[model samples]
Target: MAPPLTPADLTPALLRGALEAERTERGGLLPHRLPAWARAQNTDGQLTMAESQPSGVRLAFRTRATVVELDTLPTKRAYVGVPPRPDGVYDLVVDGRLLAQGSVPGGHVVTVDMTKGTFAHTPGAPGTLRFDGLDGTVKDVEIWLPHNETTELVGLRADAPVEPLPDGGRPVWLHHGSSISHGSDAASPTAIWPALAASAAGVELLNLGFGGGALLDPFTARTLRDTPADLVSVKIGINLVNLDLMRLRAFGPAVHGFLDTIREGHPETPLLVVSPILCPIHERTPGPGAPDFSSLADGQLKFAALGDPAERAYGKLTLEVIREELARVVAQRAAGDPRLHLLDGRELYGAADYAELPLPDELHPDAAAHRRIGERFAERVFGPGGAFADR
Candidate 1:
């Protein structure tokens, strides 16, 4: 067996899906979903945190190594009174198939107090994750990072030298949305809905899903515009309603402006605009959704809509309202942009599916729902005769 490689051995070329690999002060590489220029424009801590989590990020290379090891520092978030979140998972995929899943033993923790809007960081040491007994033949390998944790790549070691895998010439599917798309409740990074859908459709994935951060931000739109993609999709509305960020007066123009930015770079690419899924709490009621503190006391976290349903009379946004506006916007623009399409998010998870696989948090879907959504999305968007189907 060869000696372990140093941190310098893991170059940016081996990374896939991340926009940037910012070298940390500790000499580790921290992946960022947004490029440096766009990250500079970030103000909200939530957006900053979400983008740094590396939802679809992975290290892709080819090697005949029978054994491999990786050192990483992961920052896991914990609510003050709520049960601690599980350690972030690392998935090992060999030649496009999932082979193993594991987690680093020790890492940093950030305890958050939702009620006080405060947090405390407890620094911890890096831990090494190991995988062994692989097929002896040279093959493609992917180490999928934790979708829900901020991870820093410290070092990598393998029996054989690794080389970056050449592009497989697959269509790149770029998708942006909220936590559901970010793999919040999904079991693993590769199991995320977008990843699942991309896998099913034989497309490369570049996910821009940011938990609580998909509120039609200009920087996000600009990032989407600058990125190269054969297919593009944006899941809108849920974040806007949950944050109570804007009213109807602002939403229409924001939606248009966001689409306009994307079209600047991808004028003819198939772009799908998706409305929010069936979030019963905010379907008729306006948000700023609030946490159900009562659940936390019961040792589980849940969310609830705090706004009144009647507030829509004054143009406050709800899931219902946002869906209508998004459909209207897409319909209005489709004449001039035939490639643009709209998909009602509910079609992926509607009243019937909700009854069977209900959202455990009343906001984010569970792993089963994610699988269901991914399967439905693949059939609807990437299936034959679908919007993104081959021409």
Candidate 2:
């Protein structure tokens, strides 16, 4: 009789879609979207937390294992007085198709008090995810991590031997944007707009969509400049305006500098600069956006732009103002760099979209909107004659 198979030894090479894989002190593997140097340059807790959440990270291998198991430690987020958030999902993809979904039950929780601007952490036991009835044929397998949770990979077991999947030599598409691009409200990791777009366009995706952290930091720009990519894009303007991070004087120069830095590494790469989509709350109103506490008290979460509409005269940014600036920047740069291109954010989602599929939270798009955006992006950006199209 044949002996039973054992757990396959795991290493960082087994991971794809992440920039770095750090060995955790607890003998686990932690995937980081940003490298250590980039992370070390920031002190913001929110950015720290957002980048640690592996939105597009996944394990890719080729195996004939009929049953596969993964042990993980996931860090979940909670809000004081609010209902507990749903457990993060684990998506199983077999040979490029989503086959099943699972979840880890316990690990850790970071509870935040929005009213007090405070947070605390509670540790819990790790959980295991099991996938059964996979075909015995040796085929590609991908375990997509949760997009909204910070996860540490502990162990991997299968009934048969496994090895890292060979690269398919597809072009890499590196994209950077705000939480909307971070898969906010998407049903699963693969459902995120960028992922969907990449799948449709037949490319590999490297997503740098950090929630509340897309403020165009120098380190982030540097990271983008340094990363290897066959195609590159930066979705700008939303986070900048919503955060009220800078005034018009700083906005232009900062954007110019960011693009300059990226050009340092990819001078002739086809680069697309996308503006923010139509967000009614911030369409005309400047922001320093704030959460609607009244809605929160009713156990619902919503956002409101706190800045006045008239603030545009003072150079306070509204989405409208941002779109104009982004257009101008791309137009000016494209004159010198023919590879540079711009896509008006409204082209993806505009007033007509708002009338049909309104942003439920007054900010982020819902699952359906994500699909719409993803499909449109694939058709407009990756199709023939599109900016990033294969010429």
Candidate 3:
């Protein structure tokens, strides 16, 4: 049996990972992946939403606590016209095994009415998660917060002492990408493709994957340039296609500039540029992606591409177009930059694979799909002779 709850305070020196935590005036702590200095550059709602999601951020420490209690306020997103999205998932891992899993319903809720293309926000009540029946022997513990929510940690209390995980000289992999990389539809925070791949590669992860926010922003490029990193990757093309943000003329220069900024930090770092994975909806079609509620009445929801295929003649972007361009860009730059390489996202999850494990939302991969992508990435990116192979 687990030890009874104590009336004592339990403190775990918070492990920030790649996050920057700010103490709330209300005795809570809000974790942000982007540093305050970077955040001050733009007030874009997409950036704000993505950075606050904490897709790859978690709290880790060593503890002997048999019963752990954590209090937090989570800002879960909801769609007004559609059914409620699943509560963001939190996972409890002990000694590197999943010990428990739960979801918090309280905190704040952000409502998005896709039908009207509008949004609303409301405060949420505080909720607590309790994990008991641990072995009680001193062991490592990791609490992975919801990858798709904005959480304000109100308090952390346990039955014993807690301290940060000691660094073991792991390789640090820094990555940046769009919503798919941000853990959309992932079963849990750590199950995200990047996290899974990182574990397999034996690398410390610094995920800059932001939902709807990887538009090749200069500030993001600057952030990557400033941050210390051994290996780096930029998963480009998808967000730019979906958002219809730039034309081929501007796209080439923008990519060059993004990489130029990062090179300022680590000139010899093995840098990989990844194009978007195959999205059938935008394969031949251009986009300003839209929610497809056609299946909603039948209790399903998906996304559809809205831009016309002929728009390509006017410099509109599509998956195929982006893939071809990314290849050419890397090939041309490779002669002058041996450290630079390209990976077609389609190679990760292509037409054949999609035939077996299709994207559930027709945009984002489901949990099962996430596993497939992660495993493939580990084998392709971290395996011998891969883009990230040690020199």
Candidate 4:
């Protein structure tokens, strides 16, 4: 037998050998593959593409180490929807090499065994992990989870070697919105509208878009309060109308309450309130469901529809109504608070976009449309020497 191994002698080559040795001693590690529909939950309690569904690209990572740990924690738990198909396998890869992978089994937390190393799956769990006896930085780490399910990452920690990227010296753009803002039908996680917008604006992003789940909740506002951000925006209105969830009587108060919550923490932050963009189908239409029969069925059971077109158009709450209300609210609050700002969602994606982009499902925009939306947002929000622009 060769001499016993020691830390100083554990070079990259030796680390790889140690991994092999640990695997051999522990009866070897099995590969975990994520299902075709893997996705990642974002800060705003929304799900964007985590993995391709039809392509079935395995999310794998490779690293020369004894163990690996995966952790995802979102600030707001109540708003983070559960994953749709909770049961699926995930593959782990490090430094372009496959190490270990396994299924998550539909729970908030799960762990894969790599022997001799402690791994923890803490969704909404506190305390970061510490690494021991590992040399060199872990260059790459990837995770694969079911996309159709709602999974949001609050925190990610690794025990191997790694370097946290600097905040890039760019002002962080913190955004809060509905599904459309959450990335709705975008091609991939990086391609989501908010992510795309952030890239174009050359800034960091904290996307808090919850799908079908973007109601103006107090808890959501609270989450936004605790998060650190340079520029902040809240996209409101569309989800309320689409769900036909509330009446005018309640709508105004909800908006006030949500804004109040955000104001509590970000008293002087540059805050923007964005009303809904245009969707003719739902523009004048009140929804407890969409035009589709299946959606209607879902709405009927949930009491999501406001049967009367007039009510949908005026009485209940429409995009136009939301715009007017948001404007008033911001104006009233702005008198006392100068940091508050307002932007109509139409400024990003609107009626004209319909002529060219026509919402495929009358609810969500297509990938191309998402690009257009991002471009417009970059131009308007960031603009030439705007607040979000690189100064």
Highest lDDT, which number? 1
Runs of candidate 3 with Cα error greater than 4 angstroms are: 1-13
Score each candidate by Cα lDDT: 0.93, 0.91, 0.84, 0.55
Q: Assess the local accuracy of residue 196 in candidate 1 as a C-alpha lDDT between 0 and 100.
A: 97
Per-residue lDDT over 1-391 for candidate 1, one digit per residue giving the tens place of the 0 to 100 score: 4445433377789899999999988777999999999989989999899999999999999988888899999999989888778899999999999999999977898889998989899999999999988877999999999999999999998878788999999999999999989999999999999999999999999999999999999999999999999999999999999999999999999999999999999999999999999999999999899899889878888999999998999999999999999999999999999999999999999999999999999999999999999999999999987889872
Candidate 3 has its poorest 10 consecutive residues by lDDT at: 7-16
Per-residue CA lDDT of model 3 for 221-332, tens digit only, reads 9889988888999999888888888888888888888988999997999999999998999888988987887767766788889999999998899989898888888898
TM-score of 2: 0.98
Local accuracy of candidate 2 as per-residue lDDT tens digits, 1-391: 4335578877998998899999998788999999999999999898999999999889999998988999999999998767788898889999999999999988999999888889899998889999988888989999999999999999999988999999999999999999999999898899999999999999999999999998889999999999999899999988888898998888988899999999999998889999999999998998899888888777878899999888789899888888888888889988999999999888898999999999988999998999999999999999988988972
lDDT of 3 at 54: 77
On lDDT, the stronger of 1 and 3 is 1
Q: What's each prediction's TM-score?
A: 0.98, 0.98, 0.95, 0.61
Best-to-worst order by lDDT is 1, 2, 3, 4
Give the winner by lDDT: 1 or 2: 1
For all the candidates, what are their Cα RMSDs to the real structure? 1.3, 1.2, 2.0, 12.5
